[model samples]
Target: MRSNRDRAILALAVSTAARASELLGLRGADLDWGDQLAQVRRKGSGAQQWLPASAESFVWLRLYLEDLGPLGPDAPVWWTLRRRERSGDVLERRPLTYDALRAVLRRANTALGTNWTMHDLRHTSALRMVRSQRLSLRDVQVVLGHAHLTTTQIYLVEDDQEILRRVHQYLADQAEPSQEAVASESTVGYDSNDLAVLLGGVPR
Candidate 1:
C-alpha cells in the first residue's frame, strides 16, 4: 500500500521471486523501465537473468526513487531511510544493508504477530504463479533462478490443509443418504451389531 523504498523492495521480491541477496544487489541500471524487467545476478552460478516484475512494483519503485534524486548506473536501487549515527559521524545515504532489511522484517513480524522469513516470500510468489496457471513451472524456475528443476518442483507439493479439507468432504459424502438408500428405504441398512462397531449404539 505504502510506496516507501521498503515496500518497493517487497513488491519486487514477491513479484519477481528473486532471492533476498540477489535483490539486495540491485543497482540503478538493473531495472528495465519499459519491460518492467529486473536483471538479477544468481547467487550460486553467478548467472545474470532478467526477472519480470509487476507494473505496480515499478510504480512503487518510481515513487520511492522520487525521494532521492536521479541515481548513477552503479548506485544501489534500495537505500536506508535514515542514516545510523552509530555507524559513523559523517551523514550518508547508505545502501539498504542485509541487517537493516532483517530489522525491517523483525518489526513487521512484531506487528503481524507472525514469524516470516524471506524464503516465505519466495514461497508465496511460487504458489501465486502456480495457482494462476498462466505460467509454466519452467517459467517460474527461470524467474526464481533455481539451478535445478527438482528445486523448483518443491512448490508442487500439496498443502496439508487442502488434503485435510478433501478428506473431510469425502467423509461427509459417505455419511449422507445415498440414492440407493432413498430407493430401498435403507432395507440393507446394518443392524445394531454393525452400529455398535461404528457408532457404539444398540437398541434396548
Candidate 2:
C-alpha cells in the first residue's frame, strides 16, 4: 500500500506540474484551503503562480499534514524524517530536499518496476490536460505557467492512431453529399469496372 505522503507527492506532481524545486520550496502558508490552490514560485521567471489541487490530492495532502501535528505557516509543507538526537530511536522532522524527494519516488517505483523522474510527472500532467479536451491550449499554457504558447504546443503531441482516426473522419465528412438526391441513381446495372471508376479505385 502506498503511504499518505507518497500519494500526496504524486498527486501534487501530476496535478500541478510544478518543478521539483517548487515542490520542495512549498510552505504551509502557500496553501489556500478556501480555494484549494497552492502558490509557487516558477523557476527562471521567479514569478509567483497558483496551482489548483485536485480533490483526491487535497484528501491525501490533508492526511499527510494532519500527521505532522501543529506547524507554523513558515514550516515546510513536506518535511524529511530524521532520527532524534537524544532518543536515537525516535524520528524528528527537517526540511525536505530535492535528493530526499527523489529518494522517496525511487523507493515507490522500485516495487512497480518503473523508472520515472520528477519532470516526467509534469509532462504526464500536460499530456493528460491536452487529451482531456476540456481546456484550450491557452488555458493549458496558463495552468502550466509556460511563458510561450509554442512551448505549450510541444506538450500536445497527438498519438499516431488518433491522428489517423481524425483524418479518416474528416475525409469521410468531406466526401459525404449534403442530400441523398445529390448521389447518382443509376446503380441498377453497374459493372465492377464502372463501380471502380465511381469509387476512384478498386480494392486489390
Candidate 3:
C-alpha cells in the first residue's frame, strides 16, 4: 500500500469508477494539475468529461509523476515497469491488464479485511450520490454512465431507513399544538360524557 504510484492509481480508480481502459488512457495534460480535475474521454463515449479529484488523490498523483519527467499527451498515464518483486523477481513493463487491476483490488481488500469487489465501487458511488448527496436520478445517470434514466433510478431507494426517518420527522412536526387550536378547544371544553360522545366512544 505504501507503493505510492499503485496506491494513487487505486484511489483514482475507486474515486472515479471510470473504465480501466479510459483511466489508462489519461495523460498529464488531461489533468488541470493545479485544480486536479481530470478530463477523461471514455473508451466508447462520444463525449468527454471532467472528474473532480479529491485533495488527497491530487496530491499523490502529482507526487508519483514528479520524478517521471514530462509525460507526452498520448503516453500511458499508468505505465507499467519491470520491477523486482518482494522476493526479488523481475516482471515485464507491459501496460497493466484488467486482471492486474482485479488482483490489486483483491490484495487491498484483504489487507483492509473488507469485502469489496471492483464493481462495488461503482455501486457505492451511486449509493453515496443518492443517500449522502441526495443527487437526482439524472445527475446519477450521467455520473454512473448509465445510458438510460431507468437504469440510474435503480440506485435510488425507498428503503426502510429512509421511510422510517420521513415518517418520524413528519409525526414529530405535527405533534405540536397550534395556539389557535388550543384556544378553540379550551373554549369548547365539555364534560366527560360529551367528550366521550364527540370521540365516538362510550365512557369506560
Error of 3 at 182 (Å): 12
Q: Give the TM-score of candidate 3.
A: 0.68
Q: Residue-wise lDDT of candidate 2 within 14-81, one digit each (tens)?
A: 99888889877888898888888988889888788889878888889899888878767988888868
Q: What is the lDDT of residue 58 in candidate 3?
A: 73
Compared to the true structure, candidate 1 yields what TM-score? 0.74
**Could you tell me which residue pairs clash in candidate 1?**
none
Query: Positional deviation of 93 in candidate 2, in angstroms?
Result: 0.7
Model 1: worst 10 consecutive residues (lDDT sum) = 195-204
Which residue pairs in model 2 clash with each other? none
Q: Each candidate's lDDT (Cα)?
A: 0.85, 0.84, 0.71
Candidate 3 Cα lDDT to native: 0.71
Q: Candidate 1: misplaced stretches above 4 Å?
A: 1-3, 81-90, 160-204
Worst 10 residues of 3 by lDDT: 79-88
